[model samples]
Target: MKKFPLLALAFCLATPAFAQSTQTTADLANTVKYRHAYQSMTKLPDWVAKATAVSVPAETLKLDGKSYLVGHLCKPHDCGDHQLDIVFSEDGKAVWGLLSRRYGKTLYQMPLGEPNTETLAALTASYHKNNPDDLAK
Candidate 1:
């Protein structure tokens, strides 16, 4: 029964870590922290709204030495031209974004306001991972 107790302790310790990492985009959207951050925007973009409406898988990634929940969201039917990569701090207290749009042969990426250089770089890297062919020239 000593082994059983140790097994129970391990299971309890692992549950939160597993749940935190496995949260999907839909799960984060419903969070109060996420809602507050998103709603606080002064001029919300239309594509951002549309993209979040669709559910996509999310992953926990390390960005700038901190854990962040990252997800790729895109406009339905026009995903090739418009896409958004969102990053939320592990605590869900902070948020950052990268918006990418393709026009003709050129692709443009605009980071939300001025995320730190490391964050912007990580976001861009994450975006490219999602779209290997969509390189930012």
Candidate 2:
């Protein structure tokens, strides 16, 4: 009877480790796919210039005490303006997508993806749907 409680406690602790391992595999695969897509599309117009000018440094940090990789994208001319700080899992799966503004105004958190014409168009439509304020005047 007492032994049952101890056994259950041990199982509970072990379950999280098992779950993390499985999740890591899926995260790794997704990261690889995303990276491949980004690399392939980096040469295309509209994105090519910006992608080339932007630098994404690799760093590890803790968010809510959980470790994550920080990938940054800076603006072309003014590196401090409208910077994007993308948080990814250790395996490179994006966990949090945020747009940081140096001007103290909130910017929309747009989805990140490769610059394929079709993919970009689809993402733009989705972004507009989610954030109507981004529409041009």
Model 1 TM-score relative to the real fold = 0.60
**Model 2 Cα shift for residue 102 (angstroms):** 6.3
What is the TM-score of each predicted model, taking all chains together? 0.60, 0.33
lDDT of 1 by residue, 1-137 (tens): 79999999999999987775578876776698787765565455676865543436888888657798888888777887888888888997888899888898888888885678887887888788888875544
Kindly report which residue stretches of model 2 are placed more than 4 angstroms away from their true locations once superposed: 1-50, 63-66, 101-137
All candidates: CA RMSD in angstroms? Answer: 19.8, 17.8
Q: Model 1: which residue pairs collide?
A: none
The 0-to-1 C-alpha lDDT of every candidate, in the order given, reads 0.78, 0.52
Which candidate achieves the best TM-score against the true structure? Answer: 1
Pairs in steric clash, model 2: none
| Residue 58, candidate 1: C-alpha displacement in angstroms | 1.2
- The backbone clash count of each candidate, in order, is 0, 0
